[model samples]
Target: MITTAMRTRASIVPLLLALGCPQDGGTASEGGPGTSDGTSAGTDTTVPTTSAGTSSSGPDDPTGDTGDTGDTGEPPGEPSGNDLDQNALFTCRDQPALPPADLRLLDRYEWTRNVGSWLSSDLANNPLYPRPEHRYSTYSDDEALDPSVLGLYLDSVGGAADSWTIGKWDGGRLRTVHEDPECQCFLYDAAPTSECVRYFVRRYLEFGALFRPASEAQFDALLAFTEGVLAGAPDVESRPAVIKRLGAAAWMSTGALHRPELGAGEPDEHGRLQLGDWELANAIAYALTRTPAGVPSVNRSYNAGFSKGDVDGDLGSILDAARDGTIKDPEVVAKLVEEHIGGIDEARLDLLFEPHDERYWETHSEYWMAHGVREFFREWLDYGELAAQTPKVEVAATSAWSGYAVENSYQNQIVGFYGYESTLDYQLDDMIARILDTDQDVFANLLTSRMFYTPATAGYQENETSIWKSTAEANRVYNVSGITPQTREGRWIELPQNERAGVLTHPAWLGAHALSFENDPNLVHRGKWIREELLCQNVPDLPITVDAKLSEASKSQSARQRMSEQIDADPYCAGCHALMNPLGYPFEIYNHAGFVRVEDHGGPPDGTSNLVGMPSPELDGPVTSAIDFSQRLANSRYAKRCFMRQTFRYFAGREETMHDACTMVAIEKAYDDSGGSFTEMLIALFNSDSFQTRVPD
Candidate 1:
């Protein structure tokens, strides 16, 4: 029976045909001679000619003979046959148990951001973007692009082609950095001839794939596929329009979609696979910034002079460094990091928060975080979830007036009686920004720093003061004592030391870790976060037969009192809960809404818990409250090492094997040497063998 799926597959047959791949025993009308596996027979994708006197096919290949050349008077540069790697490009190739090369697919965010930067349009809301299914990081190298996902990719690119116009093409893109006359036709509005198409396709591969030279086979297949597209297009469409469509097709190819961390050439004597110039450039840029090396962005505004003018967003200098091999130096990499890693100036930060300007691609939320430094903390701390799924917050009038001195009458009335969980994401972001600008003890500061941005102080840089004030007042749960609507000077303020410590103690983090839509603390989840993320310890999953539900909350007992009876009483539950509950119970000083609780149910809340079996003996005993816990965690070497590991996982897009131990040790030393500067650790990490080299299977 004919199905919708069948019809969808049938519709794109022509475009696939244009790719010059044919099924086994396929007819010539399908685009080319068919191999048994439906792949091209050779490695060259350039169209070949039947000229008998043709001496050689270029430097990579020295064979004087051309294959099965028919005297069609075609161009002499084309290779013998359609030579694309069908398995790698068209299907999910079987990965080796330990693959020789490290190839990570560009996550949906990276793809959307890159495409948006290239096109200079906002594509963040594009429905075609496939979000990462993982619970933590947005990217995962372990995931593969299967057949179903490939179909989505094909549809996405095809849709992009349909919507694209000639005017949208950025003609000036990569032109200054790439001065090759033959390759200048990339997204050009002018009509390119048959001969110019090959050069155009090659350039597309090079730029789209982040300067990695396309293989001869890939070049030949793409060239023929592009020609087929042009020849077969309806006369209703203009040549430039057709070329744009073809450009979209090439943009979504395997070479463009997946980033190659395979490094250059073969393994060395020590079995190290050092990244090539282009590969290294791409790795550095992606690790620090969301975009590739040569893309125009404020992050790449380095002082290195290039023939192309050194504009704010111009990254031509980086491309030049890669080409000249200066980027291979560790000092150069460190310099680039130092130059790019910084906070936005007040003027620009104000502008970013202002109404959107059509001239810029960056948004208020994204502009200030160009280097993704803030984002790293956001994910690592996992606090952003509060904004996504806010839990209910209710603050009484007496508490609001006495605790935060609710001065605003409207706020007092609204907040004193009732409140909802206001998203404190912006507040946390601002706090991180302030600390990063200081650029000292990044990890330590994140854990134990009392300085923060309340709504009253949010507007000076990010222009979020008034909004934050209203929200905080409405929530009536402002735990910080000095912050009020009237204190709107827009400066960072320190909370009372006894009340708060670090990001974990922040209201946002507390609210995010709370049980969904409840005023109750999520004991297991909070404990698990500490166990896995901070301590680098793993908790066993609950057995299938176990009913993990806790007894209902009541006015008779406190949260800790109620939870302990169920979790600690059971032998099996206690076995795992012992690792997590003690770590989590310290946070009970604050309610689910992040309000400092004077009383829970009927009595003073017990926030005390014992930390046992910790890798660091100093951190093994203890714990009075969240503040005390934060102080201990801030000083723990074990915690810092775990943070470094998390950082490695985040940037490398995968879990570290034993091979990464040296890198970890080096990063630790660098962190200590720089007095715990996160930036210095990153520099050390980027230059480390684990980051720069790969292992061959």
Candidate 2:
């Protein structure tokens, strides 16, 4: 009697279990964290109790202040971050079913970024590099680790560690540890004093590797491991080799490899578990900085002359607060969030178009916003896929029709060295960065902004040059029309509002969501993205018995006409197509190449479509074109809430449920309070219960 959805859910549990994460009552076994080597750390296995004087009182008496805790009572403490007064403004009618705590594995993008920044190596490009889980959102945790991935992690950790070197900037150049008085012990001393080893372990292992205050047992184990490496060496020359091996083991340890969110103490009276100080620190760090601590070396060209805020000092404050448990204050967290995201310069947007090469980090030390923020837009819009997969073949220029030449000419437009698809990707990224830089009405602007980034807006970076000698010479005819020469010098041109609306009408997005090589439109998938992603609604998968193929193309009829005759008329397919096709048909104004179509298959293309039976009654209406539809979507309150829902999924690393009602409501309020600023929404999310609290299995 199990339904298909139930069976699918059941299948994922085995996949999670196979990954070696413990699922027994939401606790880590003896083999967890400190004892990855199977050597018992001899630390207390029992959950730690709250240091604060709060006891397991009545359901609403956990904090003795019902207003502070909202519907789900607060954990034992002097009000953790989630207990802010604003949380009580709206209440959760449903029971709190916060996501259970587990070890969140870093995604593939993070691993690659870490390998480059921390190890200073391109080893992530190797075929041997471990492949993590694949998911739409960058923040989704990997549930299973393949055997091959484990083996690769074991084999590659040592070499990756060896490639890294601790250095300082001196006179605008990098100085090795050999020249540093304190760091020199690591390079030359074979039989270093105990004091030397402790400093090394604290500096590299605690902050650099484990990303938290190492447990006493962990510290002793690593200290012993470091001494053993030095003592077992054959010569004084071997001292240098010891550091890499020591670093490798630290990097390989589970404490460094996975982020543990199991709350330090027992579950509260409401079964709500609270994250420990160190765990919360890391949670905020990953949410904001995408690292355990700041690594200025991530930007290889960092000089002492740079005017950005003190990286070490800023991270030191966060760590100090974690150790003192002052990070539990929502006010403290809100201030930290402001410091991280506020006052971002628009110039940083140039980095988005920069290829993520070694030079990319050299020229730009910090991103415009958090890397996670940038990734959310890329993943949400699904435009990042265009750069990786540009399977659309260039249409051949033929004398048969002038429109064919227009579609074919785009491939020849030189925008640096990128392919036509990649150019579009970069262009869309540019538009997104501009919107984000404003930090006002972000979701609405993203949907309705007429400003567009063309090739002329490529900025003054050394590797980038404006490819357009003239508007006619550029690829604007079919690719992106109405771009002016004034778009140069980092200026974005306002495209005709009638021709374009938001990013959905952008050539890159339109083309990315279109058919491979055919001149016909890709209806279902485009509609599917809009239906599920924007509306936060689900459409069931097509049954395996259904062939799902569209009717063959005909020069006599428009693509929409053919689809209407076949898909709309068929009762079996009409059910789902009704949900999607109406949403997609409006986009038929643009062809597969993303060119505005005047004629389709010798006839005028029908771009009229309507939304019916949607979650928002405001959105369910007739539309003349994609532009009008996009404007409607931008203005709809339901669509804006859906954007917040999507943002929660990216940050929380899971889908939002009824259990997360309180968090979602708070986030929406924060968005409204800040005039729809993404920065404020992130602050509200970081302070939400679902982010700071856990649920024990």
Which has the greatest lDDT? 2
TM-score list, all predictions: 0.72, 0.76
Best by TM-score: 2
* Candidate 1 lDDT (Cα, 0 to 1): 0.53
**After superposition, candidate 1 runs with Cα above 4 Å error:** 1-100, 117-141, 159-203, 208-211, 215-240, 296-315, 347-371, 390-423, 456-476, 480-491, 517-521, 553-556
Give a tens-digit lDDT track for model 2, residues 539-605. 7888999986654644346668777887799999899888788888888877665666666666676
What is the Å distance of residue 544 in model 2 from its true position?
1.3
Clashing pairs in 1: 43-217, 45-220, 45-221, 46-78, 46-79, 46-220, 47-78, 447-502
- Among all windows of 10 consecutive residues in model 2, the one with the lowest summed lDDT is 46-55
Q: How many residue pairs clash in each candidate?
A: 8, 0
Q: Write the per-residue lDDT of candidate 1 for residues 1-697, one digit (tens) a residue.
A: 9643343344434433233211111111111100111122222211112111212135555442334222111223422111211112112233211112444556655665454232333333333332345433534333445555655655555433322232322332332223345544544535566666665565454444324444445556567766765666635346555655555655544445556555555576666567766667777777776556654222111222111222212345555556567777989888877766666543233222112332221211222444456557778788755545642544332133332323332233222222222126656766676666666887889889887655432221225443443344432344544324322133345777877887887766776787642234366678889988887767887799987665554424556876677668878778888888888899887776566777766567567888877767879787889889988998887777778877876666555544355566778788889887877888887887766765532
Backbone collision tally, model 2: 0
- Give lDDT: candidate 2, residue 684: 86
Candidate no. 1 TM-score = 0.72
